[model samples]
Target: MTTADTPPRTLPSTSDNQLLADAGEGTRVEFRGLVKDYGTTRVLHGLDLDIAPGEFVSLLGPSGCGKTTALRVLAGLEAATEGSVRLGDVDVSRVPTNRRDIGMVFQSYSLFPHLRVLDNVSFGLRRRGMRKKDAARRATDALDLVGLDHLAERFPHQLSGGQQQRVALARALVTEPRVLLLDEPLSALDAKVRVQLRDEIRRIQLRLGITTVFVTHDQEEALAVSDRIAVMERGRIEQVGTPEDLYLRPASATVAAFVGVSSVVPGLAAGDRVEVWGRSLPLHTPGLNGDVEVFLRPENVLLVAPDGPSGIDATVQESTFMGNFRRTLVRTADGALVRVQHAASDHLEYAEGVRIELAVVPVAARARTATA
Candidate 1:
C-alpha cells in the first residue's frame, strides 16, 4: 500500500516537539537575572527569560535596548556581570563560544571567499577533527537541509545574496547546536527576498526543531516569524505574548504606539469617562481623571458623509495610494492630523480641500494618563 493510503504512523508535529505544557519544566534555555554593563552604563537590567525545548522566540526592540547584548551573552560571546546562564539544567556561564553548543547566523554573510560552498559548511566539522569523508557527508546533509546542495561546488562570490545567506544557515546548522542564535539575518536582503527567505528560514527551523532566539528591530518580521515575542524597552521587557495578543491588547501606551500606528487625541477625562472630538467613551479604569490622551487605531476609524451631523469635522489634508490600501491624512478643527487607512478599492473620492467626518468605534477608544 502507498504511504498515504496505508494507516498513517504517528509522527511528531513541530508544535508537539517545540511547545511545552510547563515551559519552565521543559525549558532548554534560561536567563536568570542577567545583567550587562558597559563601563558605568548598564545595558541589561536584571533580565530574566526562559525558552522551551524547541520554541522559536524573537527578541524584539529598538536599537540599543539590550536585545543584542542578551543574545550575545546566551551565545557566550559576552559575559554577564550578574545572574546566570543555563542550558538544559547545566550552567554554562563561563563556557567558551565554541564550546557552548550553540550556532549563530549574523546579518553579514561571513563565508570564506577562498572556500567552495561545501568546504565552507564543512569548516566547523573539520575543526572538530572529523575525517574528511565524514565531514563531507555531514556537509552535504546540511546543504540539502537548506536546499542548497546543488550549489555545493559554487564559490561564495558565484552565488546570489539569498543563496549566500542560505549557505551561512547551512554552515551554522552543520554543527548540530542545541540553541540557534539569529542576529538580523534577513536585514541585508531586499524586500522581496526578505519576505521569501523569512518563510524558508522558519520552515527549516521547524523541521529541525531547534530552539532559536532571533533578534530584530523590524516589527513586521518579528510578528510574522516568531512563535512568541518579547518586546524590550530601556533594558527591560515590556511584554511577551503571541502576535495576536500583543496587537489586540497592549498593556501600555508605549507598546501600542511601538507595535502599530495610533492616533493620540486630546480629551477631557472624569473617572472612567472621557470626551474626545465631541464623542463620549467609558474609560472603565480607576485613578484616571482630568486631561488624558485618547488612543485610536487607524483600522478602528471610519469615514462618513462630509456633512454628517454626528461625525467630527475634518479637512482632507493629503492622500496617497498604497496599492493594497489608501492612506488619507485628515486635519481636525484644532489642526491635528489623523491618518486613516482605507482599502485601495474604497471608491470614496477625496481631495485636499474637501471636508470629511471621522468616526470612532466604541471598542477602539482608550484613555491614558499623559507621560512627560
Candidate 2:
C-alpha cells in the first residue's frame, strides 16, 4: 500500500504548471435516440439525454438496464443500433474509440502487471507518439492530480485495490480526454475505500472541469456525486433529475421505487392530496383520483405520541441504528407495514406500541391499477 509519507521522486516541471493552469470546461455530450440490441434483444430503446459542458452525470439502474451499454456507446466501445452520439457540435457515431478522444475507466483496474505505475500511466501517451521524457512528465502530473505521484515507482502488485484504481484513473486522465467515462469504477473495492475513491474521482473531475458520464447501480453513490441522475429501467430512462428531485418528486412509480427506499402502501387520492393512514398529504403530481398506491419515504414518516389524535396506532417490528439516524419498521393496525426514519437518539425497542403519522408533505403516487 502507498502512503502519503512517501515523498514524490520528482518535482513538477514548468510545463506541468502550464498544464494545470490550462484546465478548462469539457465538451458537451448528447445521446440522441440511442438504441442498442444484441440479436433480437433490444437493450436500449430510443434513449435521449443532454449533458452540459463540464457537468457530472450518472446513468443509474440495475444490472441489464443498459447503463453500461449506454456508456459504451458514448465511448465508441459499442455501436448503437440506431441514432447518433454527439461530442460538442460534431456527430461521432462512426468515430473509432481511440479517435473519439475519450478516456474510460472500467470496473477492473486493467493495469499492466509488469509495468511500474509511471509507465502504466504513460502507456497511452507513448502509444500516441509522444517522446518518452514528455510522456513521463505528463503521466507524473496526472498521478499528482490523483495524489498518487509518490507511488509512481511501485508495480501494480505492490498497490492496494484503491491505489490500483487510482493509478487506472491516472492512466485514463493522462491524455486529457475531452470526456471521462467511469463504469462502476469503485464497485470492486471495500466500502470505505470505494467511498474515498468515489469522492476523489468527483474532486478530480471538478478540478479538470471534465464532462463525465458515470454508470452505477449504487443509489447512495449516485446521489452523493452526480449533478443529475438518469434513472433507467427496461431499456429506457424512467426519470432524469437531481438526487433530491428524484427522491422527493419522482416522475413515475418506477423512479419512486428505484431511486430510494419507498414503502408502497394503499391510499385514497382526491384532488391534490393523498390520504394515507387517515392523514391527507399533498400530492407531488396531482392527477389521479380514487384508489392508489402511495410511495412513502422513510424520512417522511414520523413517530408521534401514542395518544396523538392524528396518528395511527402501530407496533414496532424492528429498529436499525444507522449512526446518525435510526430506521424503524412498524405495522399499522390494518396490517400495512411502514418504515419511519428519525433521530438516532429517538430509540424504540422491538414489539413496542407506538403511533405514527405521515408528515404533511407532497408524496408521489400511482393508481392501484397502474403498472410499473
Candidate 3:
C-alpha cells in the first residue's frame, strides 16, 4: 500500500459524518461572479470557482494577484464588491467572520503571549463557550495530532519558530472548523524546517479530512500539498489542474515559465510540425505558420559529443554541482544561453570554457506564445 493509504487503521466511510467527502456532486464552496474592488483598483475580476468538499486546493500566484482577497472574501473578512460566496448549500456572503465556521492559520504566529501552549490551542474552543475542562481535553488531543503535546506547558516564547507555528495550527484545528484556510503558514520558517513542517501539515490535514484552501506564492509548496492548484494572474485564474497536468502540459507559456525553470527558443509552426533552429519536430498543437517560442526544461536537455546529429556546437560557460545533479550553463553557436541539468555521474563533469555539444529531439520541445 502507498503511504497515503497507510495512515488510517480503519477505513472511514466516505459518506460517514467523519469522512467529509465532497459535498455531494454540486456540494461545494462556490464563488459565483466574485469581484472585489478597492476604490479605483479591482482585485478580483468576476472570479468563479468551485472547491469540492474534503479537497485540498492551493491558490498560487505572484503578489497582487488577488488570491488573498479571494480567501478573505470566503472567510467573511472582506466583502465582495459583487457576487456571492456559498459554502455548500448556504450563501455566506453576509455571514460574519466568527459565524463562518472556518479555521485560519496565518504566516504570523498569533498565539497570545500570556497563554501556555495548551491554553493557546484551547482559546478558540473556550471562546465558543465550551467548559474549561472540556476545552483543555480537545486542545490536548489537537496538540497530540501535531506531536507537540509534550510542550503544552511552555509559552510561545519558549518554542522555536516551527513549534510556534505548529501551536498556531493546533489552535486552528481544535475548533473542528468545517473549512481550513492557510495563508502562507510556512513562510516564516527557515528552508529546512519549511519542508519538514510542510510534510507534517499535509499529514495532519489529510488525517482530519477537512476542506482546505491554501494561498501561497511558493510554487513548490503549492505543488507539494495541493490535490489541485489554481494559478492566478492579474486577479484572474489562468488555469486550474493537478500539479502533474500543470507542470507537464501548461496551457500557456505564462504558466510554463511561472511553475518551473525553462529555456525558451524561437520556432515556427507548420501544420502539426514545429521547426526549431534547423530541425522540424512534431507537436501536439494544430496548424500555425507564424513565429513561436519553444520552452524546454533544463532537465530535458543533455550535453553530448559534438559529432552527434542531434548535437549543436556549444561552449560551457559555467557549471555547478548540487550533489544529486549538475547544472551547466552553455552558450549555443547562435549565442543563446541554455541551462542543462545532468545526473551526478563520473561521465558528466565539465569545466568552464570547455567546448561541448547540446542535442534535443523534437519530443522535448513545447511551444508557447512569443508574447508570453
Candidate 4:
C-alpha cells in the first residue's frame, strides 16, 4: 500500500523527547487591521485575523489574493500600510524580522550551497552569538526532529528536493522561534514527496505545539492540515472556519465554489428549503426566499436509472476513475454541467443517458439576484 493508503502514525502525548521539550508553549499571533499597498496599488485591504496559541491556521486562496502579502506583513518582511502585528501581547509591527522570534520556511529551499547540512542548520544560531559547540548540539537535535540527522555531512546539491527542504525546516526550527511560518514549502516537491513532507511538517508541529501560519493556494493541502482556514479573495477574507465548517457550511457562493467542488444549479427558495432540479433539499443556512443558485457537491449527487420517476435527465460528458471512486461529469437538459461521484464499480461511458438525484442533504446557496 502507498503512504497515502496507510494510516497516519499517532503522536505521543508527552513532550519528554529532546526536541519537543525544547519547543515549549507557543505564543499567540494576531494580525489587526493589516493593510498593504505597492506605490499606487493596494494589495491588502484592512485584513483582520487572530490565531490562537499553538493553533495551525492556513491562509488559503488563489493567486493575487494577498495571502502572501498578509504573511509577509506578519513576518515583518513587508511593512503593513495601516495596522499592527502582535506576538502574544506585544506589538511587533516595527520589529525587524530577525528580532520577531519567528521561524520561516519558504517554497525554495534557501540552504547554503557550500555549507554542510549541519553547518547550514546551525548557521542561524551561530549568528546569534551562541558558542559553536552549543549551536552544533542544538542543530543536531533539530535535524533529528525532521529525521535528517544521518545526512549531516551532505551539501545542498547532494540531497533530494525533499531532503533539502527538510534541511531548511530543521534550520528554521533550530532557533526555537515562538512562531513558525510556512510559505508553500511543499510546492516544489513531487506529489508523493509533497504529501510525505506535509504530513511530517504537521506531525512535527503537533509535537512542538508551535503557533503556525501556513499560506497555500492548494485547498486540499490547507483542508488536510489546518485547525482553521481563512479564505481570502481580492485582498479580503471572505470567511474563516474549521475544515468541516468551510466544506459543509460555506458563508458565500465564492466560498462554496472555492473550498471544494460545487455545481451551481438554479433553484427556488422557500422558507427553510430550496428546490433544485425538481428536488427539495434543506438549506445550509436560512433566510433565502426567492430564485437562488444552489451549490451541489459531487458526493451529494447520485446516478440513478434513466427512467427513474423523479430525477434530472443528463448525458454523461466525462468520467474519471479515482482510486476508489469515479467522478463523472454530465450535462443536464438545461445545459448545466454537474459532477457526480459514485463507486468505481458503477462506471458510465461518455454520452450515456442517465438520471441524477440530489441526496436530501442541506446545501449552500445564494440569491439569484445577487452578484456572481
Task: Find the candidate with the highest lDDT and give its number.
Answer: 4
Q: Which ten residues in a row have the lowest lDDT in candidate 3?
A: 17-26
Per-model TM-score, in order, reads 0.88, 0.91, 0.89, 0.92
Write one digit per residue (lDDT tens) for candidate 3, span 1-372.
112223433323335422223322222688999999999899999998889987889999999999999999999999999999999899999999999898999999988999999999999889889999999977887787776888999999999998999899988888878888999999998887788778777767776778889999999999999999999999999889999988887877678878877887677877777877677877654445678877878887779966776677889999988999888999988777888988878485488888888876557356765664
Candidate 4 Cα outliers beyond 4 Å, as residue runs = 1-17, 285-289, 347-372
Lowest summed lDDT window (length 10), candidate 2: 2-11
Name the TM-score of candidate 1. Answer: 0.88
Q: What lDDT is reached at residue 120 by model 1?
A: 100
For 1-372, candidate 2 gives per-residue lDDT tens digits of 433344433424435653456678999999999999999999999999999999999999999999999999999989999999999999999999999999999999999999999999999999999999999988988888777888999999999999999999999988989999999999999887787778778877887889999999999999999999999998999988999988777888788888889777778888877788777777765577887888788877777766665677778878777999888888877777888888987643444554444342444444343334
Q: If the candidates were sorted by their TM-score against the true structure, best first, what order would they fall in?
A: 4, 2, 3, 1
Poorest lDDT segment (10 consecutive residues) of candidate 1: 17-26
How much does candidate 2 score in TM-score?
Answer: 0.91
Q: What TM-score does structure 4 among the candidates reach?
A: 0.92
Q: Candidate 1 — which pairs collide?
A: none
Model 3 stretches astray by more than 4 angstroms: 1-27, 284-288
Model 4 agreement with the true structure over 65-114: per-residue lDDT tens digits: 99999999999999999988999999999999999999999999999999
Clashing pairs in 3: none
Task: List per-prediction Cα lDDT, in the order shown.
Answer: 0.82, 0.84, 0.82, 0.85
Best by TM-score: 4
> Whose TM-score is higher: candidate 2's or candidate 4's?
4
- Pitting candidate 1 against candidate 2, the one with the higher lDDT is 2
